[model samples]
Target: MKKISSNRKKNHLAWTIALVMAAPFACASDVNFSGFLSVGGGMLDDEDAVAYGGYDEEDLTFDRNLLGLQVSGQINEKVTATAQLIARSNNDYEVDAEWAYLSWQANDFVKVRAGRLRTPFYMYSDFLDVGYSYAWITPPQEVYYLPFNNVDGVDVYLTGTLGIFDTSLQAYFGSFTDDLVLSGAPADAETRNQIGLSGTLGKDWWTLRAAYHQADLTIDVTGIPISQTATLGSFVNTLRTFGFNSNADRVLVEEDDVTFAEVGINIDTGRFVAAAEHVEFDPGDAILSKNIREYVMVGVRAGDWLIHLTAAKAKDEATHPETGIPVGQPLPVVGSTNFLIGTLQAIANSQAIERDVLTLGTRWDVTTGTAIKFQIDDIDSPDSVLVDGTVVSGQQKVFSVAVQTVF
Candidate 1:
């Protein structure tokens, strides 16, 4: 897929803003327009930490700043149309369509929607980009860095009261295609046969939710199939020369099944708030690793100010090719091939990441619709390596401040 250039993205955003600004005039009635904005700047204590926070050493960048516009119109008594566009500083002020969907209220208990929609992958998936909706300056990155966020398809949602609890259920089917940032580089990625189910139950100030999603995934590494990597390709070819075609195929990166499961709970009273979520990813492929992510946040409100603490972690399980190459297996080239295999195994093992972050933040309500926040994060990733192949050691600190508001 061709990536959109920054210049083109800017032009697209301008055109989109013009169209949205004229929407009310064109519709004349029953059309509503609103927007949200977040302007932020931050710097990392260590230059090597840039990979961890997207911040440069001692340089404040407004990478987190963003603007979103939403337009919704009631098409009839039972139908409505909504569209949202967002421009982000990190993307060079690129505008992107976050959502464009048509919804129908079958009755008070059920609703259906079609077109592009947010994937219900986590507790805050639906409002991931809307910083004003959440107390934290940003969502926990450990669990929120999934490559795909939205899908193109349809969904059915049902909500009602169950005794003293308010309950909701949702099911969706969709496909997604995008250029994703992987290992600090852009990769062409696609997901098909995407299906998911989610449910939530809430009463009073507490809520619980769970979701399950599965899809067939394909990712092009270095603009080529993963099986074509120089290292992997050489290994596979060597096996093939030894009449091990099946073994070679076992190490290939063909279409693979991937699954994601998540569960979360939250307690939100007027003065106190607590939330935690756990998610697991099983990428059933030799080229991809399975991982688990979790986070917990607690906060207390004092007058117009809220203080919060969060801890989050992610662990990637090591994966090995199924080619049955033993540690002492004889190589075609005695010393060189042995070294090659050893290096490859070490690389695979290094992909296993055990990292954690601790954050302290405060949100001050400047007005009913606006908030200002400051946060500091302590990140630890001893086993993880940066894009430049440098191992990250000890702990790094990042400081950030932002103002978020909704119109």
Candidate 2:
């Protein structure tokens, strides 16, 4: 079934690419074409460590590489249509539709966009895949690793000058459904009643941004349901019999409200660049715990090269609730349900993380619209799992190199 879906995606992408290639001849001067590409690879020092996004100890898989094409056409004096198709190495070479929208220029200060749009959650969320536009080989994964990326809906944007400061505001309403990795397994997920607002204020050499978004999130946990295993099932049944309904529900995932908030600042003064951002995720009353992530980066430019340092961290905001089951206690029928309880508790605690990473990198512009970058990361994850779910204590080192280009 997965293979079939992949084939369909490929066929659709082929047709889209053909149309885009022929658009210039068909529409004469009304259509424009552009694209971006990134070829990258990385490796970890520890061979036992689960690969980071497909990179292994000594293998360079280019799984992080991607190519994207964007086509836009002017339909009339007040409206335009834009679409972007991207093919990623991680998706088995299947091209996916990243953006397809119709934009309307309502006035000089206001505009509207309707269709599939990028979710405005962070400072760099909109242009995440365009590596040539950013200093890092990739954005901080601790903050950018959210499962949901886009929404299908409409948004209104307002931009103008406020005194000496240039200001912009955007409001959007949308919904999204996608497949996500949950607890090391694939699961179907959906976000309903998704709404968001973001604003930016800038003057001279610095800019400040803030955004808020919320939605009702639901995920199908049938693959690893809480009551499917014999031990877990018996434990949950015992808890319910003992009037621990809240505890049981806390261990199960269901429909709940998820909220995200972010604030960031960016500075650029010709030769110096600095950026810092903080974000929070609140999964209210869900099995998932609340988390906070933040990062600070500073860099200096000399000729065609820019060198930067970054520090980032992710921490859990709440500890797992006590299940109130006594350890080493004997219970009727289920002798030692205590062990099962402890295992469940440990799983919950594993979801909480206290991790930090330090990185140093250099990006050299090789040409007008191309760059080559080299980076080294020192990661310290004492109580957290890596992106691939490999548990690592203390510190580990990873190195990466990439070339990015845009045309």
Candidate 3:
């Protein structure tokens, strides 16, 4: 696919009109361009500060604004190309090509694509683009926690009917790079190279999938604060450093390797849909957990309103393949098992992952291209918890409202 290199805002009014007029005589193939822009503002219902690592949540900041453009064309009966570009608040005015792949149809039952492509590791990977999909916003964060967005590689897809069954299989091998290690310690210059496979089976309203991923990790050290006068001061300095510094400072990743596996299913009737997934990760000598992550969600649509409920949980522990050491050791610190100590333990146990969350939200389609969303989230942490800029012993709650639209 040709990369969408232009960032200029363009008008396609004349082209659209001509295409519509020529539709009758056009072949089965065509070129289509579509995109969406979503701008929204939201706030945390409570004004109090909630601290996670060392810093309090930025007080009710502007919700992220996102834009995406997609262009696709069928070159002939057996060839096609697709390209997508996305812009987000985190990158300010910068826009990047998110997906650009060339596909070849080998037969009625098989097709192949290679290039920079979306990794089909999760349920929504294929249709994450904003232009032609419906959703008040993005999927929940807990269910879609992949660190790297895309991989440079190849995909083989098989889709056809076998007897009474419809089947799909996708297998791919690819490598990815990101500043933060995908499943291990946060090395300053972290890298991961991965290979993965996913398959699906479905007929009518039911579908199922299983995916597996394995990667080699590499870490490098570039720049970071060496020391601080006090513990709190040191922690605060680290947070501020990461927040303010661009990619100038560097750190080396001492140990490297990660493995992940996931399986999921989806069922949809006219009025309701249900989905669930289970994922697991092994830290492989980095500062993260070797644990299992899982979640389930259900949604119902009635007229112009849609309601969704989600529950998720994660369990952290020592890498099971390792031999006879105690499962894991508690982080050392003064004053019982405190928040700071717990967070460190959670980090060091390179495997201490225990968290559960429940979220309830409703989306109202106010118009063709706009929607309003309100959600209530309840969080549970039996281990010491980080509270409003302070350490607390247990559960937490948060509420948010978002107005999302496309133009």
RMSD values for the candidates in order, in angstroms, are 4.1, 4.5, 9.3
* Per-residue lDDT of 106 in model 1: 98
TM-score of each: 0.87, 0.87, 0.72
Ranking by TM-score: 1, 2, 3
Residue-level lDDT of model 3, residues 1-407, one tens digit each, is: 01112323221322332233334224535877777776544444333433221113435555456788766677677877666667776567466666767689999888998766788877777766552244435565555665565776788998877688788888877765444432322333323456788888888898888888777755432232222333322543443343422111111234356777889988888589788888877766654456678888899989988898989786767532222222234333423224333434433453355778787878888898778777666667664434234554435555655666655
Model 2 stretches with alpha carbons more than 4 Å out: 1-29, 49-54, 225-243, 318-341, 383-394
Clashes of each: 0, 0, 13
Model 1: per-residue Cα lDDT over 205-274, one tens digit each: 9999999999988775533332324444566666567555664554554567889999999899989999
Q: Please tell me which model should have the higher TM-score, number 2 or number 3.
A: 2
Error of 1 at 132 (Å): 0.8
Model 1, which residues run further than 4 Å from truth? 1-28, 48-50, 222-253, 333-344, 383-391
Scored against the true structure, residue 405 in model 2 reaches a CA lDDT of 96
Candidates' C-alpha lDDT: 0.77, 0.77, 0.59
Q: What is the lDDT of residue 109 in candidate 3?
A: 83
| Top TM-score model | 1
